[model samples]
Target: MLRRWISTLLLGLAAAALAGCSSTRLVDGQVESFSTLTALPAPATYRIERLPSQQTPAFEPIAALAERALARVGLQRDDAAPRLLVQIGVQASSVPRHGPSAPYAFYGPPWAFGGWYGRPPGVFGGWYGPPPWAFGGWGMGGPTPLYRRAVSLVLRDAQTQAVVYETSAVHENVWVSDPAVYGVLFDAALNGFPAPPHGRRQLRLPLPPPAP
Candidate 1:
């Protein structure tokens, strides 16, 4: 019985650890510019611009990744006279979540002689005995903070100054740092490009394998 209880506790801890590591990436957005257009527009050239606050060296690599995604969708980098301008922005935040509650509560009688398990016969209850499983609240703890990373991409007609397309992707995890997260975000942001699903939709994309 003791060994079985220990095994069950270990399994619960393992399952909780796996759950903490698992993350979900949510991709959803609206396309304000695709309504008037009949077919996906092929711009001659496009230029990527970072948000005023995001103009920093750290964002350079991220911008390059966004550019690559655009290129895949038939847009070439151009400094001057580009038909479309791409604006990329990134936002990250920490969300606090309450940890799992204790699994078992101890309440029972006090032990006396003859290995008495429960409380004695009395009006008020005796001391509560610990659960059969020695390690009942092993993993339960304080609030855990989770990190969320989001990326937004917007495309505008250079001449008309009208918003053509836009999309955003958000990911939640215990710790969000992998560069592949942004890559996947951009991919999901531009999934349908000029045309996307009308209503909000959930997108699940597999993350790249960890480097050896």
Candidate 2:
């Protein structure tokens, strides 16, 4: 009886570990842009404009987070005669899950997880991209509902009003409310900045812990 109990305990512990490993929140999506420029002009001041579609009060905090991210990419906020205008938008929607294919697979092409090009090879090291069917696989498992939360950042020339750069980050999960997750998304959105990676790719960022 004692031996059987020990085996059961070990099994429980292993199961819990696997659950923790698989429960990670993954942000996966393609970033498409029209510009071939490799980087944004240096030392440019920007102003944030919230679209009418994002009029909710909850967006105030997310906007602040986006500002911080923009700063990280060397863009500053200048309301007075700003050189660049940044339009921020966010949306959340319920997507139908079909078959056993993972959610990420459904959203991106098969080569999304293959490899990274454009910049250098080692710049994205130490970070793990999405796994095969990590989100949810089609036909392999029953239909599991998932929510997609996406944020977009668009940079335009303040004077010309011509869009210079735009990118978006998308995440899939059962439910997401943590603000830090948005930070990760914004970072991914601005990964390549004015010059983004060519073609469709799966940009992976570490999931932030839930807010207390």
For lDDT, the strongest prediction is 2
Residue range 95-211, candidate 2, lDDT tens digits: 445634644423322111112223231122222222233334334454445655677777888888888887777777654444665678888888877677755567877776554
Name model 2 segments beyond 4 Å from true: 1-26, 36-38, 96-143, 174-177
Error of 1 at 4 (Å): 6.9
Candidate 1 wrongly placed segments (more than 4 Å): 1-37, 99-139
Q: Pick by TM-score: which candidate is best?
A: 2
147-204 per-residue lDDT for model 1 (tens digits): 4556777778888978877677776654444466666777777776656764456677
Q: In model 2, how large is the Cα lDDT of residue 182?
A: 68
Which 10-residue window in model 2 sums to the lowest lDDT?
108-117
Worst 10 residues of 1 by lDDT: 106-115
Q: Per-prediction count of colliding residue pairs?
A: 4, 11
Candidate 1 accuracy as lDDT: 0.57
